[model samples]
Target: MADIKAVLPGDVMDTGAAARDGAVLRLGPGLVQADERTSAAAAGVLHSDGDLWWVAGNRRRYVAAEGEPVVGVVVARHGEGYRVDIGSAHDALLPLLAFEGATKRNKPSLAIGTVVYGRVVVANSFMDPEIECYNSHTGKSEGYGELAGGFMFKCTLGLARRLIGSTAPVLAALGSELPFEIAIGVNGRVWVHAEGPEKTVLAANAIRNSEYLDAKQCRQMVKELLAR
Candidate 1:
């Protein structure tokens, strides 16, 4: 793992390690290549995963990428697919045959406003994005499907990623005091549920307010929420 640091636009990233390994580097958002050099295109933290680099910041809207899991809401059914709103500029397509056990004779019937957790299968600038609720190779739902009976809300993409990542302190802090089920999508959608509606509301509010808090601060915030 490389040490990440804050970067500003036009700042060149040190890719000496990747160059030494003769690896082709993949640049993620907020970076661009010019004059045979890669430089930051936006102000944010720079991160590297071996030969890949990306920047993380507080992004509210989503730009679909292949294989990234996202939560979507069904808006319309057209032919063999459903149009879903994933907080992206274009509506994503959720195909009927893309589910784990779906068939032409038995397609998944999703009504308008139904919430779902799925993965982006195809995304392009000129075409509509496509999402699926099942793993193509394993042919299993694998936690990707319709979400029922929960409150769904949107957050910054940076916060959503943190909630889904391993070092999510806000979730851990709240989990210690209450039991809840949460589904986080990288596209900024979050669905939360608990044993009761009041607990669920509390949990959701705690998460909603934890965007800028550190681990210790998040714990204190959760404690205060519990007290209330």
Candidate 2:
């Protein structure tokens, strides 16, 4: 046997992440690129257009080694469930039970733009990776949710990283204290939850402009309590 464990890339049509503009790359026969940068936790291989490039998909930001934790983004809210867009085409679902004291009715109260830092309960689900915010021993919000506030003023990915969990406080152009919560997914999807819609918009602007942010940036995000 030719070492069946060593799989090769399929045809271009067989690959799903072969996108243009650096979105994807075709490695070669039976091997396509699957990530642009490291820290993606997992990697993928495919054969698309006879080229190979790393495309980020459903890859965990941190490796899931039984007790390791990873962060993810929320893509959808299904009444009592949520679909997280953690670099995967198919968003993983966090059910009502995922939340503390959650019920069929109160389950729908959670916002969709929440980021969750959870322990990977079931890593290799058939279609997508599954997770549980609360462990079997206890129940909690899984160290995820509206952790901070502010909007992304800049559109670039670099600026987004600087703003996520940045201690920079947001003061409006008009001198109003901008109170907001910003959830930045590893995939560069920034979600903002502000006390006032206008404040949120300003924070987002500051986030976008993080590249040019001054020294007196918002250093204090909201009071945060999470596991290290």
Candidate 3:
């Protein structure tokens, strides 16, 4: 598990993280590399995950980072690609051929307002970020594609991350009660689908309510929800 601690702007981070075998350290959001040192650029919880370090804040607006999965809404069609809003300052470009087995003549015909699950392939300050609906390593969709049905809701980025963790208790608790499918985006969007609209809404609400609950609390909450 990663060690997480609260930090404020300008706080100096452990320099030893960058000194290991002269390996360059990867900085995530709210972190910046200074002259031979790493420091916090925003107020948030600092997280250290191996060679990758980041500070997670409570801001609703998302700053795109490469390799992060996101759920975006198609806003417009631009040339050979579609522009998608991923709750960031700039819309990301999703090329028509970015999908698995896609071609120029046969591409995904997504209409405006369609929700898509993708990964940020190119993220930087100079240009609009680029996203893709296929995993580059396996050349497969791998759950990265259009989200056709169900419901989508926004949560804090922190909650979204927690929901996607391998040991998320809320998901397990809900799963024990009823069958459902979920797609979580690191950018704060969660899509849930169940057998019916009522069950779907119940699952969504349960997850949303589990944000601050402990594991036992989550299970109990789910139990109470199912009973009612």
Candidate 4:
């Protein structure tokens, strides 16, 4: 089982898991390194995944972090890039050449309010963040690009994280019932597409309601939804 404990601001964290020789520790949101020690920067539950540690709090506003996949809406076309609203304090810049194989002569023309899935390439507190529609290492699209013809909705950041996990019972339950395509962004946005609008709405609502449900409860909820 994973170690999960509630913590308050300024609480020192046990660094044993991150203290393995030659292992580098990665700190996530609400955690900070002060005086060469790790401590909580916000009141939340402490969670550790391998050498990465973070504090999960009830925060609706997003703080951009590099390499996190996000779903954003194009709000305006700026010079050489588009300003995207990624549920952050500031809009992120998506350069025209950020897409796979894009160049000066050939680039995507995105309209305002268009939805896109991209990864954070640069996130600095001093400047606005930047995003890209392709994998920098592999130079592949990797399913990062415009998200077209889907129903988008917002949920809590915690719920978004849960839906993105590999073992999300709600997703598993929904998958067993019908075919659907989903795009989840850590920024608390979810896009769902199914064979029909009704099915899409059903799947999205199931996901929203399953945030606090157990595995068995998820399955039962899906069954009840299908019966109605």
lDDT of each: 0.86, 0.44, 0.88, 0.89
Q: Which sections of candidate 1 miss by over 4 Å?
A: 6-28, 31-43, 49-52
Would you list the rank order by lDDT, best first? 4, 3, 1, 2
Poorest 10 consecutive residues of model 4 by lDDT?
A: 16-25
- What is the per-residue lDDT of model 3 for residues 1-228, given as tens digits with 9 covering 90 to 100? 368899999999975745875866778778887687789989999877667777889878888888888999999997889999999999999999999999888888999999999999998879999999999889999999999889999988889877776547999999998999888888899989998998999999999998888889999998888888
Candidate whose TM-score is highest: 4
Better of 2 and 4 by TM-score: 4
lDDT of 2 at 141: 60
| Candidate 4 lDDT, 74-171, residue by residue in tens | 99997889999999999999999999999899999999999999999888779999999999789899989999997999999888877776657999
Error of 4 at 125 (Å): 1.7
Q: Which ten residues in a row have the lowest lDDT in candidate 3?
A: 15-24
How far off is model 1, as Cα RMSD? 3.0
* Candidate closest to the true structure, highest lDDT: 4
Error of 3 at 82 (Å): 0.6
Which has the better TM-score: candidate 1, or candidate 4? 4
Please give each candidate's TM-score. 0.85, 0.42, 0.91, 0.92
Tell me the deviation in Å of residue 144 in model 1: 0.8
